[model samples]
Target: MSRFLFVVLPVASHLNAPLAIGQALRAAGHEVAWCGPRTDLRPLIGPDATLYPTGKRYFRLDGETGMASVRTLWEGHVLPVNRFIRDAVDRAVADHRPDVVVVDQYALVGALAAHRHGVPWATFCVGALELTPPDLPGFGDHVRAQLGRVWAMTDLPVDDAIDLRFSPYLVLGLTSTALTGATPLPARCVLTGPALGHHPDAPAFDWAAWDPSRRHVLVTVGTMAEHLARDFYRRMMAATAALADRVQVVVTASPDVLPEPPAHVLAAPRVPVLELMPRLDAVVSHGGLGTITEALAHGVPVVVAPIRHDHPTVARQVTDAGAGTEVAFASATPADLTAALTAVLDDPGYREGARRVGESFAAAGGAAAAARHLAALAARPIEHCPSGTAALA
Candidate 1:
């Protein structure tokens, strides 16, 4: 049995995929440990896997939005922390020498540290936004320039042909082409679909309270977007209120973030999404890849309003797949949200499209496929693996 260490970003969406894959690997007889913020990972990965706490909590821009905030996050948080994360990875490697390292695409330091130690590492693409095809350039010039600074901090020389975020050994994409649409991928790229993870401990949902006659709709803006999307949440609440006669809404938000909802809406800080997804007819969210794909996995359509980050790309993919509609976060009114929700819940085509994507996800293999790929890489040497970099067209 081989030992595998996962270096993941502190974010929930990013951690969920690797954590699921790690659990699968362990179940398959391989020993696995996670390296990240312990507090953030413990609850998700569970006690079965060991944890190596590395680095401090990430800086969060709660009230920030748009491309400018995106840039600030990259420059102020990600870039500045590269060296610290690299040190942490080195320490983790020294403490427990794993046969291979599995890295979240957002955690560049993991890749660099693995390379420096001459250990094989696989890039786990949590979201499709990081997968840059020739048609879809990976990063803009400004972003690439910032990436160079990150590379400079590392001991290994930068390979222009390979994106640092993508592993030279393996690239495990967490979404299928059916939802993301067909795009050219490197030989090492393995599209394993979304690993929504096993949430067996998810709280029991109050199903009896929901009206059987009305369409059940879930409204959420994801973890990062929750702080940045108050306006969007307000609009959603109003829209859901307008559709009270036609639908019953469950809006996920903390009491501090959102006001008390009308009788038609259930405003909770958290909901067991996996359990609830199958029961819902539609989802309204910030177009986060995790939420979008999870909804699709359950054959439920979505109404996406992209706020920032990779949300726009994921939103476009949803619209292109005929699984949902996209609305501009800034300009979207209650009417727009109400109309979009009505269309998705009313139309059978959207549900069919979502089911199609769900089929693709099942066929692609979820956490099992990802674990299989990582297992294969573990047995092989880094030099024997195929690698490529993403280039902007």
Candidate 2:
């Protein structure tokens, strides 16, 4: 049994995959220790795992300053939260001294902790990023090239986290079987599908549970969704009105970020999406990997509205798979939302595509696959494992 230290991002979506992997590891008789601000995740792991609750913010993307030396780990700007995690690592290293450290992709603090000691660290990618095909043309042609240089500028030992070479580095992406021309990794990369743990238990929607006849549409901006999408929500509300008699719409927004919702819409605070996804007919969401994965996992189609960051990339993948329609952010007016959503809901192709993706993800043996690879990763010398997880079982 390995003593595993799981460092998860505090963000709600990122936590699910780690918790799922941790639970499976514990069930296999391994000791799992979690470090993060985990009040929201207590229900997922319960008393089975040890908690380290490092009260770091996990950094926000929009407004941040300072930390010029340690910026690569972040996809966006954030200083205070990064500093909190940075300081926490110093303390964690002197104490637990875990054998294996599994972390979320954005949580580079794991790299710092693991590198300083000899602890094996692997980062799990729970989201999507658009990377220009590695072999394509010049460096300028690669969309993700600049992101790589930014990553290498940091003080972390594995500065160039994206280098396709082998010989031990931070961040081993635990991806799915899609393997669709993804980056070639020198070290082992585990293709561990959608991590499934506990779906939040919430009261049934009155429209879906009570009426049972009305098709339900669930609309949500994921975590950080509300921050970047207030205008989108207002327009979405107007679109929801258009579907009034046809579909019962439940819309969620950040508590303080947006104004009141329209009367026709069921305005909810951030609710557990797991509970909501199972009952809904379709989801109107930002193209965050977590939201898309959950929607697809339940065989629910999506109307993907992408704004910034990875949303555009995720929207494209879902669209490519025929699981949803991508209403470009610049054109996502209420009429556009209504029309795009209608296109997704009316088409049988969308539903079938969602189920196909969902079934494939379910068959990938998520938590088990992750546990197998992590256990193997801890046992083998870091350099022994090849990129793309060629050496991982």
Candidate 3:
């Protein structure tokens, strides 16, 4: 059995996909371990899973927008975290001695550590940030330059051929072409769709409270965007208020955000999202990849109000696929949200689009496919090609 070590960010969306994949590998008799903060990893992964803790550190974007958010993510979070956890990751590798290191896209140090140890590694593209379109010229180049700088900072020789962001062996993109449209990706990249699975830490909700007589709508901006979502939630409540008799809006937020939500709205700090998806008819969200993909996997349509980071890109993909509509996050009025939400609910075409994407997700094999690929990579012989590039041969 091959040993696999997953080096990931502490964020929920980033951790979920790899967790699912790790579960799959374990089911196949492979040993799996994770490297991240213990407090964050323990609850989600359960007590049995082995963990190499990097301790706790919080990284915040503080509501930046567009390219600035991208800069903040790399400069403020990714780089700093990489520097902070480099020693921990090195120790994990030295001790765990994993045959394959599964590296999150943003966790550059994982790839570097694997390379240092001469271990095969795979890239987990949990979001749409790395799948930038041609229209955004130099975006990929800029990201690659950042990766180069990280390597240089480690005093490691920068092999231009080796892009640390992606593994030459395997890259598991947690999305399908249905959402990504015609965006080009790396040759080694496998669109494994979204690894939709159970989250052990998901909070339970009172399913009995749900009103089946009216259409159900979920309004959430995911975990990271809560600060930016207070105003968005206000706008969403205003938008859905008129339709309260016909539609039930479930807002996932702290009571403070919606202290006295209308009678028709259900407010919560967290909800059983996967369990609740089948009951949902439509979702109003911040265009997060995890929320969008999970909703689509259940054949539930979405109305995206992109907040920041990869939100706009994922929003465009959803709109382009005809699976949903997007609105300005900061400036979109209640009227805009009302119209968008109404269109997805009223129009059968949007549901059909979501259904098609959902079918594609099923065909893509999700976590099982990722696990199979990692297993194959583990068994394959790593050889230097004619140009001195290391790859599975």
Indicate the residue-level lDDT of 342 in model 2.
Answer: 89
Reference-based TM-score of each model: 0.91, 0.80, 0.96
**Candidate 3, RMSD to the unseen true structure:** 1.8
Q: Any runs in candidate 2 off by more than 4 Å, and if so which?
A: 38-44, 58-80, 130-187, 199-210, 255-264, 381-393
Candidate 2 on 284-340: residue-level lDDT in tens? Answer: 887777778878888899988776555666777788778899886556678888988
Q: Write the per-residue lDDT of candidate 1 for residues 18-90, one digit (tens) a residue.
A: 8778879988999998898877877777776688888565665645555565577678767866666778887
Task: Kindly list the per-residue Cα lDDT of model 3 for residues 18-115, writing each as its tens digit.
Answer: 98999899999999999999988999888888999998678864778766677777888888888889889988988999989999988888888887
Clash count, candidate 2? 7
Model 3 TM-score, all chains together = 0.96
Residue 30 local lDDT, model 1: 96
Point out the higher-scoring one by lDDT: 2 or 3. Answer: 3
Error of 3 at 98 (Å): 1.0
Q: Rank the candidates by lDDT, best first.
A: 3, 1, 2
RMSD of each: 3.6, 5.2, 1.8
The Cα RMSD in angstroms, rounded to one decimal, for candidate 2 relative to the true structure is 5.2
Ranked candidates (TM-score, high to low) = 3, 1, 2
